[model samples]
Target: MPVGYFVTGTDTGVGKTLTSCALLHAFAMAGKSAIGMKPIAAGCENGKWIDVERLVEASNVPAARELINPYALVQSIAPHIAARQTGIVINIATVQRAFKALQEMAEVVIVEGAGGFLVPLDDRYDSSDLARTLGLPVVLVVGLRLGCLNHALLTARAIHVSGLSLAGWVANQIDPHMESQAENIHTLQHRLNCPLLGVLPFSEKIAAREYASLLDITHL
Candidate 1:
């Protein structure tokens, strides 16, 4: 079976794409063929989703665009709203098919979730539902900031409730000025029942490959 992971976050703008790309790079560094997938994306620039493009660039295994992003909604809004506006239905089956296709093309596929873990993809299914459908272990990205303790713990609980494994987590230092960040991370390390993959320092200009070294893919 192909190894894979579903990457989700505590909330939006929590560096899901960055972490996904870093995972792709990390797997590649480990001599494993890896690719990244964004099953549903809401935003686009110049008729292309930047996150999807970044994933493609970071991947060691080449894959078709359709397989990488099955639902490329044009609007920069919630996925369900974007799908409705575009007269598209976010179908989990379609995404599952694409994920299976990507699985065949690489040894490891890092599937990135839209928005948060529970963000709605359609009327009946949210991102967590989609993650459950894929049946891959999840890597939660906790953006190191205020209220992260609550967000991370709640998300971890939700993942357990969803019948999925919280394989690991990444602490992306998104807030440089936030005081007592170490204490927050230490608290989460003791609370969350998973390995701390890495502590990514805050950097605006660093590439995902640079961040790859910070991540200990061994736990993954």
Candidate 2:
């Protein structure tokens, strides 16, 4: 059977891409062939998708551009809006097809979701829908900050309601000076029904390969 995870976040800019890259690096360190899939990305610069490029760079397993990211929207905005502006209809079936192909090529495929768990891909489908379609366990990226507790709980609730398992969660310290960080993690540890994978300290630079060692892949 194919093994993989759907990496989602409590909200946007919560280090979802960073965590996904870390997973790829972690699996690589363990001698497992790993690949990262973006599926849908909003932002683009010079006709290149930054998140997709980052995932491709981090992955040990090489995959086709279309397979790694099926939807590369031009605008750096909500996926639905970007799609509409570019006359693109975000298709879940296309993403599913790409995922199946990736599964055949790699031992582990880490799929990174765009924006938040409930962000809409189109008028009908959202990130939650895509995660369910892939049937992969979810690893949430919680940006530790003032409103993290609420966002984390709500995102966890949505994942469960979608009938998918919350495999584990990572607390990315996006806020370096956030008060009582330990207490916040403790609260999430108590509230969430899954294991606390790891807590990453805030870093000015993205040391994904270094941070990869910090992730507890055993839980994954």
Candidate 3:
């Protein structure tokens, strides 16, 4: 079976991309052929999708960029709005086809989601709907900071309601000075049934592949 995980976050700007990239680098370092996908990306600059470009670079195989990110919108907004801006409709089946193509050449595929679990993709399609269509387990990236307790549990609850397994979680320290960091971890460690895969410290001077060293993949 292809080793894969649908990477989601507690909320937007919660280091989901960083964790997804780390998984790609970690698996590659462990001698596994890894590939990653953003599938649907928002935030295009000058008509270029930056996040999609990043995932293209992270892949260990020779998959085409179009297969990695089949849906790209030019507006830097919610996917539904972004797709609507250009009269483009985001299709879940197209993304699934892209994923199937990527799987033929990689041992592990890490798929990163845009924004949050409930972010809308089209008139009726959301990230949660796409996750269900893919039928892959999830690895949530929890942004460790204030209000995280509520966000983490709520996201965990949402994932459960989505009917996918929460394979594990990564606690990303985006705010270094956030209060009671230890307690937050303890709370999540207790409330979340998945394993605490790793805890990353805040860093302003590190790249994703470099910051990936902090993760203990054995726990994953």
Candidate 4:
């Protein structure tokens, strides 16, 4: 069976894609064939989702675009709204089928979720539902900024409630100027009940491959 993870964040712009790409590189470093999948994505530039492209670039395993991103909504908005606007239904079955295909193509598949864990995919379902359907361990990316403690704690609780294992979490230092960043990390380490896989420093020009070295994949 392929080892997979559902990557979600505390909130949007919390470095989920960056963490996902770094995981791909880290897995590759560990001599495992790995590919990254977005399943569903909102926002596109020049007819491409930037997150999908970044994942592809970081991946060592070659996969078809369709399997990597089953639903690539053009608008940069909430996925449910984007889908509704484009008359596209966000189907979990379709995503599952694509995920299975990716599983066959790699030893590890990193499935990156859109927005937060409970962001609605459709009126009837949300990202948490998709993670449950995938049945993969999740890796939460807690963006280190103001109000991180509440967001991280709430997200962790939700993951547990959803019956998914939070394999580990990455602390991406998104705000270089945030006060007491180390204290914040220390608090989460004690409270989250999971290993701290990595603490990524803020860097505007660092590549994912470089960031991969900072992550400890052993926790996952």
> How close is every model to the real structure, measured as TM-score?
0.98, 0.98, 0.95, 0.99
lDDT of each: 0.94, 0.94, 0.86, 0.96
Assess candidate 1 and give its TM-score to the true structure.
Answer: 0.98
Model 3 off-target regions past 4 Å?
A: none
What TM-score number comes out for model 2?
A: 0.98
What lDDT score goes with residue 125 in model 3? 77
lDDT (Cα, 0-100) at 47 in candidate 1? 80
Which candidate has the top score in lDDT? 4
Q: What is the lDDT of candidate 1?
A: 0.94
Model 3 C-alpha lDDT per residue in residues 1-220, reported as the tens digit of each score: 7878899998888898888888888888889899999888888787778776666676677788788888877777888997887998889999999988888889898999999888998888799999999998989899988888898899889999989899899999999999999889998999999998888789885367875676777765
After the best TM-score superposition of candidate 4, give how far the Cα of residue 5 lies from its true spot, in angstroms: 0.4
- TM-score between model 4 and native: 0.99
Q: Write the per-residue lDDT of candidate 1 for residues 1-220, one digit (tens) a residue.
A: 7999999999999899999999999999999999999999889899889999999999998888999999998899999999998899888999999999999999999999999999998788899999999999999999999999999999999999999999999999999999999999999999999999998888887489999988999997
Candidate 4 on 84-172: residue-level lDDT in tens?
A: 99999999999999999999999999999999999999999999999999999999999999999999999999999999999999999
RMSD, candidate 2, Å? 0.8
